[model samples]
Structures are given as C-alpha cells and as structure tokens.
Target: MNVLLQVADTAGAACVFLGAAICLLGVVGMLKLPDVLSRSHAATKPQSLGLLVVLAGVALRLHSVMDLATLALIGFFQLLTGPVASHLVARSAYRTGQVERGDLLFDDLDAQLTEPGQEEGQGRRDSP
Candidate 1:
C-alpha cells in the first residue's frame, strides 16, 4: 500500500474510534444527568461532535467522491439541526415544568418565558 493511503487509513480508524467513544460518553451523560436540561445538553454537544467525526471517518474510508459528498451532506445537516432540536426539546420541557429547579443555578429566561397563547403584557407566566 502507498504511504499516504496507509496514513489516511490509520487516521480514519482513529477518528472512528474517538467518535464512537464521544457518542458513548454522551449516552452515559444523558442517562446519569439529574434533569431534562442537562440531559439535553448531553445529547447535543458531544453527540453532534461525534456524528461529525464519524462522518469524516466514513468519508475517508469510502472510494467514491459521490459517497463522500453524501456523507458530508449528512454531517452538515446533523450539525445544523442537532442543537436546535435539543434546545427546542429542553425549552418545551422547562415550559411544561419537567426541569428540576434545584439544578438550575440561574434563570435569565424567567422574565421572558411565557406560556403559549398568552396575551401581551400578561407577565412572565399565565395563571393556571
């Protein structure tokens, strides 16, 4: 095998291993975290990083440029959507009272957060 190909294969293997490890760590965090917000953080950051790295590894291992382009597109979409999706889920959980207040150090959104369908100037929350 050519020296460059050998080096690339080694690098790709390393990326795959590291990516898998990061993804596993994220899964562990999601399971071990005390609340919904922390779990959402765990699910997004490391998981997205892992997904990108794994996609890179797959791209490196593939023979065709078309296959690599597909991997790149998948990784790009994952990067674009992962954090947004997690944030939406976390925000919905917090609004629905699923988050643990004790775990929160500070809440800047307290004043701005509002219930759905609430009228303007209704204050921070809608009365139950």
Candidate 2:
C-alpha cells in the first residue's frame, strides 16, 4: 500500500510538471507563429491538452469525490470552449482580411462568402 501511494504521488508530480512544460511550449508557439490563424491554433490545442493533463494529475492526488468532480468539470469546460474560441478568432481574422487567402489550401469559407445572389452578411444571418 505504501509503495503504491508513493508511485501515484510520483506519477502525479510528473504529470503536473509535464503539463506545465507543454503549456509553456504552446505559449512559445503562439509568440513565434507569424499569423493569427496559426497563433490561435497554438493558443488552443496545446493549452487544452496541457490543462487536461494538469487536471488528471490533480485528480490523482485528490482523494475527495467533490475535488475530482470539480476537476472533471474544469476539464470539460476547457475542452468545450478552447477550440470554439480559437475558431472564432481565426474566423474573425479571416473576415477582417488578416489571414492570407492564398495561403489556405481549401477555401470553404471563401466559397460560402462569395456564393452568388448572397449579399454581404446575408448568408450569415441567424434570423429571418
């Protein structure tokens, strides 16, 4: 029992350290990336992964059910919001002409935006 507890503690500490390192790399990527789209990608993907890892480490260390539940909730919200926020940032950058159209391999948004008979902002209207 003592040996198992020690192993769990060591693994939890390693996970927390590794997660922090991953998050640091993501910040570096965000700073080094040249464009808004790439930067947003850097901002979300690694950060989300790192956060989940950190939460898992916390869960391992915490014996309380409530603490584990709270960690799970935090991880859920991070997974839910991170990519959505990144997508919104990238979409706005593309709309505002910050992203270079020529750089994109598949321009689906361009097709939607330029569809014939659709006025500017008309295709995106939420309500009739």
Candidate 3:
C-alpha cells in the first residue's frame, strides 16, 4: 500500500511538472511565433490543454472530495472558456487589423482587414 501510494504521488508530481513545462513551451512558442494570430493559437491551444493536465494532476493529488470537486470544476470551466475566449480574441484582432497576414501563402481574412478605410477602423490606441 505504501509503495503504491508513493508511486501515485510520484506520478501526480510528474504530471504536474510535465504540464507546467508544456505551458512554458507554449509561452515560449507564443513569444517566438512571427505573427499575432499564430501566437494566439499557441497560447489558446497548447497552454489551455497544459492547464487542464495540471489541474487533473492536482485533482489526482487531492485527498479531500471538496478539493477534487473544486479542481474538476476549474478544469471544466477552463476547457469550456478557453477556446471561446481565444476565438473572440482572434476574431477581434482580425476585425481590428491587428494581425499581420503578409506573405505569399493562402489567406482568408485578407479582405476583412484590408479596405480603403479599414486601416482606420482599428481607431486610435492613444486615446484616453
């Protein structure tokens, strides 16, 4: 029983550590990515999943039912919210022309961000 408990503890710790590392990787990727949309994708996908895995590891390590329930709730909420938030942000960025889509690759949002007066649609960020 003791050995089994130790193994469980080790596994949980490993999961948590690995999840954190994955999150850091996502952050690094976001920083290293060339464009805003790409960075947002890095942030919204791998990092969100990494958070979920970390929460699961915490849930595994928790001894109390309440703690487990809380962790599960957090995980559920994150899973539900993360993608929606990402989509909204990405859409807003595309709408506002904040993302750069230059290069000779396939593009879809090209028309949305580029028009005669569309550049001004982003408005003044200097406004108080």
Candidate 4:
C-alpha cells in the first residue's frame, strides 16, 4: 500500500508538471501567433487539456472523497465549458471579421466576400 501510494504521488506530480509545461507552450504560441483566431486556438485547446491534466493529477494525489469530488467537478466544468467558449469566440471573430488569414492556402470566406451577389462593404465599416 505504501509503495502504491508513492507511485501514485510520483505519477500525479509528473502529470501536473507536464500539464504546466503544455500550458506554457500554449502561452508562447499565443504570443507568437499572428492573428486573433490562431491565438485563440492555441489558448483554448492546450489550456483546456493542461487544466484537465492538472485536475486529474490532483484527484489522484487526493485520496479523500470530497477532494476527489471537487477535482472531478473542476474537470467536468472545464470539459463542458472550454470548447463551447472557444467556439463562441471563434464564431464571433469570424462574423466580426477580426480573424486574419495571412498564410491560408484556400479561404472560403475570401471567396464569399468576392461573390457577385454580396453587398459591397457590408462588413467593412472601417474600410476607406
């Protein structure tokens, strides 16, 4: 039992460390990314996964029922809300035309904007 507990502790620490590293990487990516949408992707995906890993590690290190329940709740909230928040941000950025597509190979939004039937400058309030 003692050895098992020790192993779990080590594993939990490793998981937490790894998660923190991932979150740091995501932060770096966000800073280095050129645009709002790409930065949001970096933030949401890695940030959510890193938090999940940290919560799971906490659950493993905590043997008490209440602690585990709290950890589970944290993980559940992260899982349920993270992607939804990211999607909302992305969609808002898209609709608002705040997203940058500098290196895009093919852009559907560009095509839509250039289509014949679309009104001129419908979303281009800032354009001269």
Candidate 5:
C-alpha cells in the first residue's frame, strides 16, 4: 500500500512536469507563429492536452473519489469547450479575412467566397 502511494505520487509529479512542458511549448508556438489563425491553432491543442494531463496528475495524487470526479468533470468541460472556442475564433478570423490566405495550403472556404451570390468577406481591413 505504501509503495503504491509512492508510485502514484511519482507518476503525478511526472505528469505535471510533462503538462507544464507542453503548455510552455504552446505559448512559444503562439508567440512564434506568424498570424492569428496559426497562433489560434497552436494555442488550442496543447493547452487542452496540458490541462487534461495536469488534471490526470492531480486525480492520481488525490485520495477522494469526489475530488477525482471533480477533476474529470473539469477535464471533460475543457475538452468540450477548447476546440469549439478555437474554431469560433478561427472562423471569425477567416470570415473577416484576417487569415493570411497565401500561407494556407488549400481553402474550401475560399471557394465558397467566390460563389456568385456569396458576399465574399464583406469585412473591412483597418490598417494601423
């Protein structure tokens, strides 16, 4: 029982370290990436992953089932919301033409923009 507790503690520490590293990398990616779309993409995945991993670590170290369940709920909510929020932000950027089109490999949205009746980015480009 003692050994099991020790093992759980060690695993929790390792997981927390890994989660911190992933979060650091994501921050670096956001800073280094060229545009809003790229930064948004970078920010979402690792952030969610880091949160889940850190939550798992905390769950492992925690004794109560209730605490673990709380962590699980938080992780679930993070997983559900992170990508949706990222997608919405990205969609807003794309729709408003804030995305750098030349950097994109291909664009299905661009095709839609060219459709005869479509508005085609009725967004204003304000320059600083």
Candidate 6:
C-alpha cells in the first residue's frame, strides 16, 4: 500500500509538470504563430489538453469523490468551451479580413460567406 501510494504521488507530480510544460508550449505557439487563426488554434488545443492533464493529475492525487467530480466538471467545461471560443475568434478574424486568404490552401467559409445562396454541393473554393 505504501509503495502504491508513492507511485501514485510520483505519477501525479510528473503529470502536473508535463501539463504545465504543455501549456507553456501553447503560449509560445501563440506568440510565434503568424496569424489570428493559427494563434487561436495554439490558444485552444494545447491549453485544453494541458488543463485536462492537470485535472487528471489532481484526480490521481485526490482520492475524494467530490473533489474528483469537481475536477471532472472543470475538464468538461474546458473541453466544451475552448473549441467554441476558438472558432468564434477565428470566424471573427476571417470576417474582419485579418486572415490572409492567400495563405490558406483551401477555404470552405469563402463560399458560405461570399455567396450564401450557393448550394452545399457546390463544394469549397481552392485559394489562389
């Protein structure tokens, strides 16, 4: 039992450290990325993943059921909201012309925003 507890504690500490590193990478990505779309991607993806990892580490350390439930809830909300928020930020940036169209290889939103009446069967426009 003592050995198992020590292992769990070591694992939890490792997870927490790894998660913090992941989040730091995300921040670096945001700073280094050229555009809003890329920056938002950096902001959400790694951050969400890091947060979940951190929560998992906390769960391992905390044997209490109620604390685990709270951590689960936090992870759930982070997963749910992160992408949605990133999407909105990217969408607004694109709409405002902050995104350079030429940099994109394929533009799905172009048809929808430029020609709203176009049918879905028309397919996405290839960026020139």
Per-candidate local distance difference test = 0.85, 0.90, 0.79, 0.82, 0.88, 0.90
What is candidate 6's CA lDDT for residue 28? 100
* lDDT comparing candidate 4 with the true structure: 0.82
Which of the two, 1 or 6, has more TM-score? 6
Candidate 3 collision pairs? none
Model 1 over residues 28-107: C-alpha lDDT tens digits? 99999988888999999999999888888876778798998899899889989998999889877876789876678887
Q: Could you tell me which residue pairs clash in candidate 5? A: none
Q: Candidate 4's error at 57, in angstroms?
A: 1.4
Which residue runs does candidate 2 get wrong by more than 4 Å?
125-128
Highest-scoring model, TM-score: 2
> Scored by Cα lDDT, where does model 2 land?
0.90
Every model's TM-score: 0.81, 0.93, 0.76, 0.75, 0.86, 0.88
Scanning candidate 4 in windows of ten residues, the lowest lDDT window is: 118-127
Residues 1-128, candidate 4, lDDT per residue (tens digit)?
99999999999999999899989999999999988778888988899899988887877799999898888888788889988988788767766788666666767767666666668455433446
RMSD per candidate (Å) reads 4.9, 1.6, 6.0, 6.0, 6.2, 6.0
CA error at residue 76 for candidate 2, angstroms: 0.6
Q: Please say which candidate is ahead in lDDT: 2 or 5.
A: 2
Error of 5 at 114 (Å): 3.6
- Cα lDDT tens digits, model 2, 1-128, are 98988888888998999999999999999999999999999999999999989888877788899999999999999999999999999998988899999999999999888887787565565566
lDDT of 6: 0.90
Residue 75, candidate 4: alpha-carbon lDDT = 79
